[model samples]
Target: MQFIDLKAQYDQIERDVNERIHAVLQHGQYINGPEVRELENRLAEFVGTAHCIGAASGTGALLMAMMALGISAGDEVITSPFSFVATAETIALLGAVPVFVDIEPDTCNIDPGLIEAAITDKTKAIMAVSLFGQCADFDAINAVARRHGLPVIEDAAQSFGATYKGNPSCGLSTIGCTSFFPSKPLGCYGDGGACFTSDEILATRMREIREHGQDRRYHHPRLGINGRLDSIQAAVLLAKLPLFPHEIEKRRTIGRQYTEALAHDRIIPPVVRPHNTSVYAQLTIRVDDRDALQEALKQQDIPTAVYYPVSLHHQPVFLRPDAHLPVSDEVAAHVLSLPMHPYLSDEQIRRVTTAVLEAV
Candidate 1:
């Protein structure tokens, strides 16, 4: 069985996708075509935000948010180490320091309690990653940020359709960034991403930053990058957007099946918060011997992956051994993501679960 089954998803939306692409081709305005603006408008409405600015990639979206927020050298952005490197990479790219914070062992999201201690005069923002398709504790994170007068940017790359306390993931923070990497919960045919904001001024700034700091043609207001998302990708995403709610429901059903079947096994299924719903971007689990279990599953033709084998603080590129975050370290050694997607069949899930149970 395929890991994500993008082919099945494509088949479901083939007609709509073809129509959208045909229109884009006919228009021939492939750069920042009309489809781009349409997608931004639809996504902004879906996320309950005032604005959405599509970017080249999720990493580019984060970089644009940082630039719009005026993060610079010597500034510190607090975030968890138990996330994709882009969470911290964007901060460092701006010559700013990423203050590593420990995550909650259950949710694997940044611990808000640890955030206050990390704040200083240089703390400009809180970059909270909604890891593994679950939203972080935005209420608590926002409380801390409000106390410190810092903006919170939600890295909702994996949790686009996820909900926390009835609010959408991207609408829960000062600024929310999500990716359209093909494997994400809501994705396009190619690399694409968007930044969302309720603040009009910040939204205006993000729009300018996304197009090389230009408020209009030949006018450069500030330093920015070519972060615009392509029209073809926008068209692909627009076609996919209409079916996203149904896909999220399918993913939830599959996740529930995995949780019920694997709960008593040697592996631990992903944890869900009381008021939160995960999109199950990765149906991850923890095992005693991750490597051994992975091998055993592979022998059965069941694929598995490790969200991260090494924490950002421990990466050779960072090389900061003194930065100790215990939860991230422990999780890196134990966490493994199983085959997950809306297209996973009941039989495939059963087979994968059976293999996992036997292996452990």
Candidate 2:
């Protein structure tokens, strides 16, 4: 009944992961090692991007991407209010404002239709999050950004293995960032992430930004952070990469089963729009009595989590008394994430779903 069975996944790939970690230990180049570059290259190829820059965490990836794009003070980055704080925190950390936008009621992703209205002269970028492992409508979001002459950054932290219109998640925008936190679809043993892009200049800048802005050893060109991914984490990702495609398939199948079993008048299963594929980073559902349902499931020893209990605009640090994001607020109050992982067994799925149905 694990929320995310990282242990089961590790057990399947333990030998390979151990070997990779051992190689890193023997090399003694913990930071910016050969394994790091190897992982970057492999990730870029998988995502169909020309370059991938490994980062210390998903938050680090977002920071590096924004720094590379020159997102500085007094700027505004339009984003969904329903996502994790990292989405807005990254912008505010740069002395920028995060313009709040509502999300689609069904998908819980940023509503592309609401994006244009939020833009202003200070708007520097449009950052759309792919929530619950399904990509936002990039085609429409990109079109709106193009019209406004604003760069679009896809916050694909939850949707790394997802697809939109036959294109990969991280390669579908000016800059796409994803997390490799242990719970992510393509995660390592610890905190890790990457930024993907075909633009050589942006790629170079991000690489530099992740390593204290040094063009060459000791040649400082710009301000940056110590955001590089470690060699051991890179090694873990390399060992897991070959098996990821199959894992994605298993996730998809499990998601389908959940959708089928959880169908009821009171339960609202997540919707996967046509022409898009979700990695099911979390199989979230909506219910009117979320807290009561969660408690009931807990009584039955079923684990459940709230992806977000409050929208970004409602957070104390980023509170906006005037913001009007009803859908984001509503979704935040009702959403509950069930146990989800590729390694979940049919019996486990049935047990979880049965509890959910009875609780609801």
Candidate 3:
């Protein structure tokens, strides 16, 4: 019945988790410790990237990536308005503009088709968010970016373990960023994130930026922030890393089951494209009476969530009165995320799906 069964996952890895944390505690190097470097190396290897820079949070990773890319004031970053605010917030935080674009209704990811039209002289980068654990169409997106000669940053916060066209999510772009928030597909005990890239210069820049732009201790070379990921969190991740492949498979199975069970005239199940494999960060569905259906499911003790109730263009902080992202607007009002995790039982999936089908 748990939305995300962290307890079950913890139980499975308790010994390793405890051992890793105990080692970290004994080492007493809480910040920028050896564990952090080890985790970075492991993550980079998994993602098929040359470097991985640990960060304080996913927001920090995005900010550092943008900073390392030299995105500055008045520079426009074209991105999906349908994603978590952090996707656009990081851009705005740098005094850069986040140009909102529509998303594909099925994937709820930024529509690459609309991206080229949004690009202008001010467009500095294209930030493609891999929403709901599914990667956006990177091949097409990358093609467009190549034409514009712009960098593409995949916001893989929700799709870290996902694959797009035989490539890992984080390694499919100029700079890829993912979160280690507790509920994410691959997560730590507390806030953490990492940036991935093959570019050595960008990698060095991100590493320096992660430590307040210090090339050497107590010597600052550029403006940056304290975005370092702590050792304890790194330890948690290292312990969990080995179990990720299994967890991802479980999630995919659960997702497939949910999709099969929720097939009805009134419910619109998630669509995983032919070339992509999702980690099912959230097994979301669309329904007309979303609030009513949520209430009905809640009455049956089924926990459901709305990833986003309003599109970014409609948010007060980033209001765009002239914005015309019709698909983003429509999907926002209808999408609902059901209980999703690697530990979801067959019975649990059935219960949730039954409630949903009846409610709809």
Candidate 2 per-residue lDDT, tens place, 176-230, comes to 9999999999998899999999999999999888889999999979889999999
* TM-score for each of the candidates: 0.99, 0.99, 0.99
Angstrom error at residue 181, model 2: 0.4
Error of 3 at 171 (Å): 0.5
Single out the weakest 10-residue window by summed lDDT for candidate 2.
207-216
Model 3 scores what on Cα lDDT?
0.95
lDDT of 1 at 231: 96
* lDDT of each residue in 55-142, candidate 1, tens digit only: 9999999999999999999999999898888999999999999999999998889998999999999899999999999999999999
lDDT of 3 by residue, 189-224 (tens): 999999999999999999999888999999999889
In candidate 3, where is summed lDDT lowest over 10 consecutive residues? 351-360
| TM-score between candidate 1 and the true structure | 0.99
- All models: lDDT? 0.93, 0.94, 0.95
Candidate 3 stretches with Cα past 4 Å from truth are: none
Model 2 accuracy (lDDT, Cα): 0.94
